[model samples]
Target: MANKIISQRISPHLWFEHQAEEAAKFYTSIFPNSSIGRISHYTEAGHEIHGMPAGSVLTVEFTLDGQTFIALNGGPLFKFNEAISFLVNCQTQEEIDYYWDKLRAGGDPKADQCGWLKDKFGLSWQVAPVQIAEMLVDKDQERLSRVMNAVFRMKKLDLKAIEAAYGEPVGAK
Candidate 1:
């Protein structure tokens, strides 16, 4: 068991204020290839030091799009911030919209801009279409500026608009 635990590669560990399981379930439900893994609860032996009820959920191991994560129900000494975020690369506008909507449910409207949103759990996620990076890397400075300007003005990214800004030529709004 120790060898198996040590063999796994580096993965993100999230801290939640007693919502490890709830957050895990919410995340697994949103992403197609995600699921909750092992759930370990605190034992009576640690109650005096941890201050948590014995048998309460202590940790939850979960997967999001096959990437492993560990969520700990540590007390609210820390928080999820914009400094760290999950970037979801999408191929189509539909994919972009799907993730944006689901992740943004009960999200912080003030924190949303340039494809970034903070979920109810206060975790930031960048939901961007893959094409945006390709567009930004174009040698054409004018086209790059267009896409950047369009992206900078929006909360959730609009792939079609960015494409239009990349010289697709569309009717004026």
Candidate 2:
């Protein structure tokens, strides 16, 4: 299982003060193509920690968007802030809306097209599309300026409004 583990994994570990397993399940349910993989506790059927009953979960591995994550029930040495975030590259407006609303279900948006928001777990994420970056650097200066102006004031990236700002076809330059 060593080779198999290394070959298909980029796991971002989360250290939860408590409820690592609960958080794992929460995340898996929210994201598409995700689920709980493995859950192991401190007190096994025939084992113990520090010669006492440490009945908490030692580790919980979860899969989200085909990516693996391991949450440890470590003591609260640190907590998640906005220091690290995940970027979701969306292809369509519908895709953008779905993730934006859901991911930010209990979170708030930051500034501009570079959308930043926190989940219920206080984990930050940036939900954007390739088109957004593309639009900003469009060949038409007027279109570029207008789109840039609009995004500077928006919490969520609006595709239709961006297109309207152009008022003409702007090639991806």
Candidate 3:
């Protein structure tokens, strides 16, 4: 007999210090088509090692914009950094602004650069225009250089500015 695999194909797991539920709720609220899933609570049997009271939330399964994620209340032994980030591909400047403003609330100001931001929980996010990817991979080197320069000088990506750089020269200003 073969064991049945009962799990998401690949879900990003987030570790937090007793705030997994709160963060999950906040994330689900911000992204459309998102919601909190089954929440698992700690049991008294593992209190000695886990150090958490019985009945407390241990893990929360949630969906953000259709992506599966499991938030674990695993204490503060670990912290989120820029090593891994969620890249949100925005189709318009409006979408960029919306996500940037919402996710940047209580975020680190220093991390707000190159379309990247660290949220209050220290999770990094990249709010970028979808067109930028298409432009960067374009065969035109002149356009690539212009887009690169424009992106370097930006915090939240502006679709119009990037598209403008696609045809203009480097120093055209």
Best by lDDT: 1
Tens-digit lDDT string for candidate 3 (19-79):
9999998898899988788888999987878898899999888888878898999987899
lDDT of each: 0.87, 0.72, 0.86
Which of the predicted structures, 2 or 3, would earn the higher TM-score when compared with the native? 3
Q: Each prediction's Cα RMSD? A: 4.2, 4.5, 4.9
Models sorted by lDDT, best on top: 1, 3, 2
lDDT at position 165, candidate 2: 76
**Deviation in Å, model 1, residue 78 alpha carbon:** 0.3
Estimate, for each residue in 6-121, the C-alpha lDDT of model 2 and write its tens digit: 24546799888777887887777767888777676776454533332367687787878888888887666678887888888887788889888877775544422346678776
Residue pairs with backbone overlap in model 2: none
Predicted candidate 1 versus true structure: per-residue lDDT over 1-173, tens digit per residue:
21135235798999998999999999999987887878888988867677888889998888888788889998888899899999999988899899999999998999999999999999999999887776777777998798899999999998888888888532221
lDDT of 3 at 172: 40
Off by over 4 Å in 1: 1-7, 168-173
Ten contiguous residues with the weakest lDDT in model 3: 1-10
